[model samples]
Target: MFVIVGLGNPGKQYAGTRHNVGFDVIDYLSEKHNIPVNKVKFKGLIGEGFISNKKVLLVKPQTYMNLSGHSVLEIQNFYKLNPEQLIVIYDDIDVDLGKLRIRSKGSAGTHNGMRSIIYEIQSDQFPRVRIGIGKPQKGDLSNHVLSRFGKEDQEEMAITIGNAASAIETVVTEGVNAAMNKFNG
Candidate 1:
């Protein structure tokens, strides 16, 4: 069994923002696999189904970005799964917009949501797929992340999110190394 977590702030206001791209990927996977992520538990909205013939739990942490680890820890403990059985999806400002980076393990860097997860879980040995949001031209990092994409970026993001969803499926079926080889450019 595996747990796939997407970190994002909950509520309509945060929807479609760069920070919510994780949630976007979760929604894409849910729709693609016909899973309903309507269950409220583990401090998140969860759905269960098979991906690549592996039983998997799809999660969207509802505790907002900074407090995401609290929710993830609960789910991880409840499922009795190891760190390696987990996969996280979130945005990264360090990479260029529309790019994706897959890593078997790494530090959270500037992402508070990922920092929370690593702090609460006490390990960094989990796989993660980071969708790049690019750095802000202006210094207001919060506003940049919380704001929705412009018309042109929105069009490009569709492709990035689709690739992210495919990457998750690859990880489940082919393992992290193969997925990284295929998807990490």
Candidate 2:
């Protein structure tokens, strides 16, 4: 089984924020694959279903962004899941808006969620899909991520999220390298 985790803060206040882009991508995947990610467990929401003949456990950490590792570790231990079987999706401020970057393993950069996951998992060797959210011109990043997207951002984010979700499907079926080539254009 594979644990597909989307990192983000939970609550209505954070619903449409850029930080929730991971959740957005997962929602797209759930809809496309007919999986209902409504089951709550391991301090997150999860849905179990088959995709590409692989039993996937879709997870959205409810412990918020900073403490994301708590839930990830819990799920990992309970399922006896390894880092290789975990695919984390989240927003990236470094990349330009609407662009996505996939990596097998790398530094957390400035992302707290990724940092926390790496700390608890004891390894950064895991697949991740980063949806670019873009940085703000000024002020705190936390405020920026929690803010709603502008009109232009909304338009681009739709296509970005949909494509990212498809790319995730590709990863499960066609492998990471192939999906990267197909999606990272």
Best by TM-score: 1
For each candidate in the order shown, give its overall lDDT on alpha carbons: 0.94, 0.90
Model 2 poorest 10 in a row by lDDT: 170-179
The sequence of per-residue lDDT tens digits that candidate 1 reaches over residues 5-122 is 9989999999999999999999999999998999999989999999968999999999999999999999888888899999999999998999999999999999999999999999
Clashes of each: 0, 0
Off by over 4 Å in 2: none
Q: How many steric clashes does model 2 contain? A: 0
Write out the backbone clash pairs for model 2.
Answer: none
RMSD of candidate 2 to true structure, Å: 1.0
Model 2 over residues 95-121: C-alpha lDDT tens digits?
889999988788899999999999998
Residue 50's lDDT in candidate 1: 91
